[model samples]
Target: AQSVSQHNHHVILSEAASLELGCNYSYGGTVNLFWYVQYPGQHLQLLLKYFSGDPLVKGIKGFEAEFIKSKFSFNLRKPSVQWSDTAEYFCAVMPGYSSASKIIFGSGTRLSIRP
Candidate 1:
């Protein structure tokens, strides 16, 4: 089945440190891209997205990512991350193949921030 994968199962970072996450997917056609971040006990928020048009997209909380169509990859990056930025991150893709189609989530990267 088509799916997204988060290479990092866990990440540890100090305050004001850099963060780079690996994301990949297996799909045959057009799709929508997204990165969702879930803070402790908090709802998931859109970190970034790639619909159509440009391959590069910016997201909230000072996050950015580049979509490589050929590689079937969309990796999230942050030059410097805060303690609050530490959370589980997931990558999803909507193939638009079905109205009932659901977004597939990566296993998630549980990020920890240290002071």
Candidate 2:
């Protein structure tokens, strides 16, 4: 079965700290990768996505992810984080198979920023 996994459940860091979260998937076919973020009270918004070309995708707020086909992974990274960056992080993927077509999210990572 096709599935996506996020290794981090919770991450606590100070302001301006570098951040990296692990993400891996098990799929042999085509797929669409995405990183969605829900800021404190904000709704889930697209951080980035990997559709066809370009393995390295960049999103808003200095967030970016690299889609490594060999590793079957797409990990999120940020050089510096802010207090406002605190939120829930979700790594998701949509397979190429034709079904109802749904976006599946990782349990989520709760990020806390301490000044």
Q: Which regions in candidate 1 have their CA more than 4 angstroms from the true location?
A: none
Candidate 2: 10-residue stretch with minimal lDDT = 96-105
Per-residue alpha-carbon lDDT of candidate 2 for residues 19-115, written as tens digits (9 for 90 to 100): 9988998889888889999997689999999987889999999999999999999999999999999999999989867665687677788889898
In order, what lDDT does every prediction score?
0.89, 0.89
Error of 1 at 28 (Å): 1.7
By summed lDDT, the worst window of 10 consecutive residues in model 1 runs over 93-102
Per-prediction TM-score to the true structure, in the order listed? 0.93, 0.93
- Stretches of candidate 2 above 4 Å error? none
Whole-model alpha-carbon lDDT for candidate 1: 0.89
Q: Can you write out model 1's per-residue Cα lDDT over 1-115, one digit (the tens) per residue?
A: 8899898899999988888899999997988889998999999888888988888898887899999989999999999989888789999988867777588888999999897
